[model samples]
Target: MVLNYPDGRLYSDDIPKKPAKQVRTTPPSKRTAQTQKKNNFANRGMRFEEAINESNAYYLSRNLAVIHKKPTPIQIVKVDYPRRSAAVIKEAYFKEASTTDYNGVYKGYYVDFEAKETKNKTSFPLKNFHQHQITHMNACRNQGGITFVLLWFSQLQRCFFMDSKTLDRHWQAQATAKKSIPLQVIEAESTEIFLGIAPRIPYLDALDHYIALKEQEHDN
Candidate 1:
């Protein structure tokens, strides 16, 4: 199967598998340690995303704010049917670039945000973001929608909720200034979210803080 971006660039997912090699026995203690390390490394990337999904489910079940991850639109170009009852997609392209990851309404305010995780300990690279996404967030904010991003620093085990405006400010200056947002800036400008057991990410608590800040701004 072949997949492509809307711009016709090839989206490569197929990696050639290396030829099987002879297995070697190792000491039991060493083997166990290696297995544990491998498992932890593999699951590290998925922890943040899975936590967000679980949190969303928790919110939905309690009749809280309605939110969901947006589905990407794909245009299938070809399909092969080797069997009467089985069909395989042969080629497809993204219909368009997605705006953001998740969106919904909360307390009469439209909420839109992107969730991203980085392994960096000191900074988050701006390359993780796209211009179209920033534009979309700006447009949402202009129309009185709640717009923010949830950033998870995997190495530090920290999460932050930063409003779109702050993101855009740094984004625009990237050409002349630093290319990444420093931890210091993030800690000062964004709201920190402590992970909880029920709703693992517990992002809504950060959202509540943003709403309060917005209200205060309006009041003043």
Candidate 2:
């Protein structure tokens, strides 16, 4: 299953398994895949946040839901005056973000989620999650929000939309016995999302599918 960190970031293969050490030396200002481009939402490249942002855009355009990426909270520590009219941010550090990556309302249901990618073909590492994220997710769920994770298995090129209930159970296990959730377990608990060009991950529809299934079960 696609597991969520307490903070609500989704874990998938496509997200870097380990956080990259900020390349302190700023490289040339050429835009990477993270920036917005002029193409249609579907044409965006393989970057994780970009795909998710585009997916959110697709949902917004279609009137499916109103979701947005959480802004990275950074603290500016220093600046350089290049000219009277221009000042470059010379030094900055990010503040600890308090919420998950994305949240909004869909069909009168509150939605909160995180996105993650992984390189490991076998299993996702537990290190991707932190304690603060867990607390945030618990709050969201308790408030009746539909919370989940979007996992991209980058190497396998597979995606999964996993519910938060399954994730909370396993994440809690770390305190007692298991330190990491096994790959075999993830495969069993998660619904695999088929990746495509349009809407990229197309995960919200999967969310709709999930909600429908739950409703059917309730009817039965």
Candidate 3:
């Protein structure tokens, strides 16, 4: 005669016992602790995206620059209608960004740039950038557009405005042993942006300095 339990499983003496999950008592490594500390620090202040949005609003209100963040495109694959007020999205996939994050006209010149943050204290890795972004920046520069990247070192709490040309040169040389741009190189080549009370990130001042340098280069 066969016997069955309440769960509809056959009651047998041969059933094996499941092993318990193992827990580690060792402390996290130095690198892991440092990364966790950086994450905590980031959580304390306003997010990078929020700060940029506020700065953009400030610029627009002052009639300085009309910049806007590009919305990411998404392909909706599945949807469910369970007799609710609205249809819920079940599954979706993100499409690749066509261009830089922020783009608009600033002082008769097209401005295009991408914003990125890194926790690395020594250098910014080239892997953060993509081929399509580089190609878009190249196209903008060819057309006399002001293209740059706002790089934030989260661990250092420092920000820099790097021109696309310099960025492109460094990106092209990533095949060598140096797969990242050193902080010293960025400090020397790029313009440092300071946080302000009103705009949060006063990037327009850096843009002005870059434009002045470009005008001087043209005059010489």
- Candidates ranked by lDDT: 1, 3, 2
> RMSD, each candidate, Å?
8.0, 8.8, 14.0
> Could you give me the TM-score of model 1 versus the true structure?
0.77
Instruction: Report the lDDT tens digits of candidate 2 across residue range 1-220.
Output: 2233575332332232222342332343653333222121212223666778888898899898899977766678798887667888877654566677789999999999877666678777666666666678788989988888887667788778888888788788877857666667877888787866778878877898889988898899
Question: Distance from true position, residue 88, model 3, in Å?
Answer: 4.9
> Which candidate ranks first by TM-score, i.e. highest?
1
**Ranking under TM-score, best-scoring first?**
1, 3, 2
Tens-place lDDT digits, model 1, residues 99-209: 887899888889999887778999988987888789999999999899999998998999999999999999999999999999999999999999899999999999999
Cα error, residue 157 of model 3, in Å, equals 0.7
TM-score of 3: 0.75
Q: TM-scores, in order shown? A: 0.77, 0.73, 0.75
User: Please, what are the lDDT tens digits per residue for candidate 3 over residues 1-220?
Assistant: 1223455432111111111123222354633554445334434323665688789999999999999977755567799987946999888644556688789989998999988777899899887788878899999999999999998898898999999999999998988758899999999999999888789999999999999999999999
**Candidate 2, superposed: residue stretches over 4 Å from native:** 1-46, 78-90, 217-220
Q: What TM-score should be assigned to candidate 2?
A: 0.73
